[model samples]
Target: MPTSASQEALTPLRPYCGRFAPSPTGRLHRGSLAAALASRLDAHAAGGRWLIRIEDIDPPRDIPGAGEDILRTLERLGMPSDGPVLWQHDRLDAYAAVFEDLKAKGAVYGCACSRKEIRAAAQALGLPEGVYPGTCRGGTGGREARAWRFRVPDRDVTFVDRLAGPYTQNVEKAVGDFVLKRADGLWAYQLAVVVDDIFEGITDIVRGADLIDNTPRQCLLYEALGAPVPRYMHIPLVLNDRGEKLSKQQGATPLADDDLLGELERAFVHLGFERIGADSIEAFHREALRCWADRFAEEPA
Candidate 1:
């Protein structure tokens, strides 16, 4: 049994916390509004909790006040979270603790390769680009540790996406010894996300299909950490006229806080649900959720 202090450091006891984690790289665009609406509807429809998480782990990518702006936008859209918002930056200590545990278990090792080196090695091996070749896995040959990486198991990581259906990836061949911490000192997404999900007791993760590929990596982390993996649902991408995903980097416009109900109807249609006229924001949720339940038989969350 863990001591009281260590127990406090472990995952909190809770149930059914589903979250909408958005990187504050830019404002809440139309695409982001859809994700928030889906997560809120699924959580509420299933009598679960909906939480907001600011994924500001990459400081250099974060725009000034983008996270706060997203919160305001969610409030304006009538989709407020049911709990205190989680900011990744505030949970660094928690992530560091998990890192220490992994290190002690010998599940992770020092890596000395750069992105360029990995890409070059991948090309030479005729493997997919961006897949690390695990050159430094066997002790890095005494080279200075530039990063820390998990030693991926040879087996496959597989799971059924609630919307997109079954998926699989062999981490060793497809991704190879993925990073846990970067040389520049940022915690890797695979580590921070799994740690936060376990800590928050998240039961479901609903987001855009653009992240479908990353799910397997996260599932592998969940297994390594002895945490139960959550069900996943990767919804269709909101595409611009050019068939590109609607994103801040793609110049998608920020959502207007004043157009809550109107945008709600728009998102409903965007998700292929029946459009509803807003008598009130509350009624709008009822009608929209009815449409969702009709489609999914039950809300996945």
Candidate 2:
């Protein structure tokens, strides 16, 4: 049998493909703008392709026309992505295909636990405390049709983040057998993202720090599918006075078209890029890109 290390080496290596996947829940706010600018700049600086994907898999929460508004904001900010945007809603069949493949490999099972049941079970078992307690791990939750969860083995999933450095999480304890498909018949973010990234040839993921904890679970799913994993960079999340992440739900002000230059300067400063002045948006973009390139070139690999 091939050694585990050698088996890992057999996995395919992909090029530098960075992407920004945003949910269509609302208009792009300051935090979202920072994330988009960072990801786009990183990809461009690395001589890689940057792409955008609409995360609209959850129909109930999606706001009408929010996706288009996000695209327009990015365009106004002068950071348009390459090629057509990929919408998650249009890739259901692809997610289903991977779900079936994992099921065939005996890596998944049907889950029949209600939210209340799982929460109670987690409290009783002294589990790490999450929504699901793996009460149906042996298929005995005593519930009806709901969803499916991938079986997480007793092992630690680890990865080195490009920005946040090295990290590890035990999938079985941290999040027991996470859902691949939801009870409402929609694919989970974990499943959909893994499938979509592989399909789109994505090699680098740049997003906010809120998703840092989710990296291990994604890594597990990628391994289960026998797919190559991408490098991850989790930027610092912008917070309000209440120490909560900035979001539309939190009443974060949207980026107005007229304030593009001001917003862009603030975003670059927030990201630690220097040499920006109170100038027109066009001049700011040019000067910022030049300064960014100079700083990046000075950094030793």
**Backbone clash count for every predicted candidate, in the order shown:** 0, 0
Per residue, candidate 2 scores C-alpha lDDT tens digits across 233-300 of 78888888899999988989888767788889888887887748856767876777666667656532
Per residue, candidate 1 scores C-alpha lDDT tens digits across 174-248 of: 889999999999999989988988888898887998998998788778777887778777878889999999999
Please estimate how well model 1 matches the true structure, expressed as its whole-model Cα lDDT: 0.82
Candidate 2 has a TM-score of: 0.91
- State each model's C-alpha RMSD to the native: 5.6, 3.3
Model 1: residues >4 Å from true position, as ranges?
A: 1-14, 298-301
